[model samples]
Target: MFWRRWCGLFLDQKRRKKSDATYKNYKHILGEFVDQLPASVRFIDQVNADVLDSHMRYLESEKAAPKTISNKMMVVSFMLKAAGVATPSKMMELPTVEEEIPEPYTREDLQALFKAMTPEERVRYTFFLDTACREKEVAHAQWADLIDGKYWVRKKTFKARGGKERQFSPKSHETRLIPLTRELMDMLNARRKSSKSQRIFPNEWGDPEGHFLRKFKAVAKEAGLNCGECETTISEGRFTKHPAEVSCLTRPVCEKHYLHRLRKTCATFWHEKHIPIRTIQSWLGHKSLETTQKYYVASAIPRIVPPPCSYSRRICSNSSTLVLLSTRSSLGAVRPEAESRVYGFQ
Candidate 1:
């Protein structure tokens, strides 16, 4: 009976959001947790900090990354709290083992990626890759947000809790105005052609850029790039006389997977740009600065190419001064005007 009651609480938690996407995430996460529990120990008293630890251990033994298992733990903790089930007092703090830092795409890799994309997609995804804007935000961007070289995001679509949506202004957390380039602005204006409504990245269907994975795979295929399966092979850059490639999955994958990669890569790029960790904390949509710092590690591995010159160049006219610094201690922004011309060390 208590087990059934807790299950009811779980369903109630899921029902708080009616949106398919929102509910889907909650169901997949919490549902999986409950399903794996032994039936005999499914009641409220049987669930405790020790059992939670055991479940976490199960997750780790199954080869889950620390971050992933941590997320699952958070979901479980939240659920238990909502159900009035208390964690054990002695073992309340469930510590997670640290994992290796994530590898993100390099600036060179980004150049190849965007260059391979069509003009429109290049504009859209560059903003996504840079700002770490959620897919919906990228798709629904408005020209009104653009002001000078920066823009604001209105939170009309933050969530669909009920008939009403929470309306918060951009950077409501700390007032986040994402900066953009003239080219990005121009692309936004050019793309806002009249036939459709106010969507920034409308698909062929003229919807809010819905079919993301489908289009992503198509673009990847066209660009001679790979996704999950072959992403590493090409990333290794082990190509010989003939560049080796990998097979792409025919099915469209989840948007979050790609978004995670894009978001992490954006943090890495900004880290290289010498942007302050606090600034990057805002850009990456992290609530805590500690969560943000994990991704901005300094790598010592040297690239074959020499650093760009310390002068602003017209190579990518849209790009501002190319900033390249060697060490964390020595920090400055170089215009790199002539940096494009020098590739001796690079």
Candidate 2:
């Protein structure tokens, strides 16, 4: 009945090669609901809005976060729609999280952190900052992915989903090339000579590296970076050396400074160099220009405009004033054309 259709739909998603992380979450959420269903409710049609209302109450009773509750509800709604079941009336709306500007590291901060890392850690972090790559992209990268001093990130990555690992593309299924800096290129070329694993960054078992947050935070701690956000003590002032899940904890501590900050840092650097936002979006593998605009770009706009008579042309009506204005604009004077494109600034 309902159980048979659920299994069939789940298997169909797997067969069609949907994202592993997505399917895993759907399965977990759906499984919980099925288990909670009353013994009398056995048919698909029996699972209606009332049943879903009970499920919502059940999640609230368990003290689930608003975002979590919303996600679970969406998953169930999608599942029910696939099975041709009616959705609950006025279902739970998604929580509105405040949009905060991404905090990218200053050049000095980046240098200090780089200096504190070990040779291996330095190379890895340096590559991330230079390329603006996601952690999963780093995990799935192979030596063969590099060509002409650039690395190509594609769908040929092994990802963990549904309690098992399989080859798949993550995030956007689009492929992109990241150009390597000369220093980073040289460093990687040297490492490639004696590397035993096919992966660019491999675990001790010669597999794609997974969950390197502990090691990254350890390096940050040694670098004297304040990490009061991620560090939670056990009892009587005993700090946890390497917690298994750093991100799943409360308050999203990595809000200010974390590994992902490096990606944003790279984007900010490009923006500072006057690189176009569309180009930055492509390099960062963002699905839309809005994602690049909202996160990667800096919120600060410099106040460099002069008063009414600041421009040479405004002071003198002579044609030579126009030449002086052009010269001054070239020498870092306010250029309205450039400023106009930056976050709609006039």
Worst 10 residues of 2 by lDDT: 337-346
- Candidate 2 per-residue lDDT over residues 264-326, each given as its tens digit: 776765665455677777778989889899765463423234332121111111221211122
Q: lDDT of all the models against the reference?
A: 0.55, 0.63
Mind giving the per-residue lDDT tens digits that candidate 1 earns over 1-346? 3645665677575665444555576667777777778777856667866677778788878787778787777767767767775653344455566755455665554545554566556666767764667665676565566665565655545332344443333333444566553345455666666436545665665445666545665665554455546422233244545444444553233222355566677666555555567777766667788777777664432333444322111123244222322211112332111223221112
Q: Highest lDDT among the candidates is held by which one?
A: 2
TM of each candidate vs. truth? 0.64, 0.69
TM for candidate 2 is: 0.69
Residue 277 local lDDT, model 2: 73
Off by over 4 Å in 2: 4-24, 38-41, 60-63, 86-92, 98-101, 157-165, 227-257, 299-346
Per-residue error for 60 in candidate 1, Å, reads: 5.1
